[model samples]
Target: MITILMGSIAIGLSLGVLGSGGSILTVPVLAYGLGQTEKQAIASALLIVGLISSVSSFSGIRQRLVHWPLVWLFGLPGMVGTYLGAWFASFTTGIVQMTVFATVMLAAAWRMFKPSKAAPETRSEPSNWLTGFQGLLVGVLTGFVGVGGGFLIVPALVLLSGLAMRTAVATSLVIIVMNSFIGFLKYQQVLTESQTQLNWHIIMVMTAIGIAGSLTGQRLSGRLPQQKIKSAFSIFLILMAGFILYQSLPALFPAFTL
Candidate 1:
């Protein structure tokens, strides 16, 4: 419980300060720290991250950072993709899910490590079809792995939709919130059918702590060195991803060894 509480603080801080990494921390916190099954961890992550992102997005709205045209173009498809992905996840096992999740963590780490070549200005407006396709892919990732997919979304927004970094961050929050809620609904249905119960006490406690941490992180964002933070955190992500794979792969393949 203490471990999950502490981890939740990290999750909120990452989201608040970086506008990313909430799902990365939330999934592991619930799964490893709290010793939950993959399904439970993912379900709880959707709820926690969705709510935290909803709260964090208000500031983005106040700052007018969101691009509604892009939001509609990208996020609507994302929602549909999320529902489809969650449906697929329901049929998979813990090992398969965690293995895929580890792959995503590595992808996130790679994104963080790469310095931005993206400009703050609009290069071009990608076609609506291309934008929706990107969103669909990201939404599928979110639903299947229980991520907010901000790491994926921000880059896609910048590259495909020509949104600036700050705008992408703000816009990704809205998309994340939408996809997460829908995914959570699916997971909740699964839990009901299986007669499984969530640890609401943990969810409530983590949400409270995460919200507080998020506020503090907002205050610290501009004050902190974002590049340095991301660089160090990327290394941590690599290590964690490797760990997750190491633990899960051998179980999935008896013949495979580290």
Candidate 2:
């Protein structure tokens, strides 16, 4: 319980400080701490992350940092894509899902190591279409692997939606909430089909602690050296990714594992 509580704080703090990585943290907490199967963990992660991001994004909305035009331009299609991906996951094995998830963790680590500093985006008919298409792709990855897609969405907003970095980050949060909740609904159906009783206790605890932790982290973000923090966290992500891959691979390729 202590470990789970600690992990919950870390999950929300990571997002509050970094504006991403909450989903990355949530799954392991549920899977390893709560002894949930991968699919269950993934399902739980979506809710936890969605709740935390809602709080964080609310701040941005209050500040008027969000770009509403971009939210609709990208998010509505993303909801559809997320649903498609979650549906696909129903046919997949946990090992297969975890393997893909570990791979995505490495990508997220790389993103943290080299965060985007893109020029302001250009809006046009063709570019708008491209942005929506990219949203679909990112949404699929999010729903399939249970990530927030913020790392991917932030960059896309900068390069494709003509948003300032702050606005892009804020807008990405809204989009994540939109896409993630739809994904969560689909995954719940998956859980129901598998006869799993979704654990609301841990979810509620994690969500509550996570929100408070995020508030603390936001306060601390101003005091801390951000790049150094993200650098260290990225290395931690790499190690965790490696561990996830190691755990899943032996079961996947038994003959080659040794």
Candidate 3:
């Protein structure tokens, strides 16, 4: 229990500092630390990520950092995609889900390691069609992997929609909240009684600790050099991805392992 709480706090801190990665960590924490099945971990992660992002978003809303128009354009279609992805996830095997999730972590780490481009001086809103398409793609990934997808959404908003980095980060939180909630609902539709009971226990403890850690992380973000932090985090993700692949592949292909 203590270890799980510590892991949850780490997950929240990642989100607070990077505005991403929390959901990415949550699945592993729940699965390995708490002994949840992949599907159970994914479902629980969606709820935790959604609630944490929603709470974190209030600060952005207060500062007027969020772009409302972008949220509407990107979030509605994302909800639909999230639902579809969650439905598809229900039929997948545990090893298959973990393997896909590890792949996503590798992709995210690669993106993080790349040099960040400067934001455009003159911003223009992305076309509705373009925003919707990106949102749908991100949402599907989020639902499938139980991640918030902020790592993807933040860059898309900056490059595709021409949002400033700050605005993009804030706006991505809103999209994540929408995607996570919808995905969680869909995932929950197939949960067993035992899973529900275990999830409840996990959720209550993790959410409380996670929220507290997020607040602490927000404070630290102001003082820390963000690029250095992101670099370190990217390396951590790469290591985690390797570990996940090593653990999951054997189960996925036992004969090949021999």
User: In lDDT terms, which candidate is top?
Assistant: 1
TM-score of candidate 1 against the unseen true structure: 0.96
Give the 10-residue window scoring lowest on summed lDDT in candidate 1. Answer: 116-125
Give the per-residue lDDT of model 2 (tens digit) for 104-177: 99988898888556664444644777878888988898899899898788877776656777787778888888
RMSD of 2: 1.8
Model 1 segments beyond 4 Å from truth?
Answer: 120-122
lDDT of 1 by residue, 80-165 (tens): 99889999999999899999999999989999998865754647767789889988998898889999999888888777767777
CA displacement after TM-score superposition, residue 250 of candidate 3 (Å): 1.6
Error of 2 at 53 (Å): 1.1
Stretches of model 3 off by over 4 angstroms after superposition: 122-125, 193-197
Question: In lDDT terms, how accurate is model 2?
Answer: 0.85
Between candidates 1 and 2, the one scoring higher on TM-score is 1
Clashing pairs in 1: none
Model 3 poorest 10 in a row by lDDT: 190-199
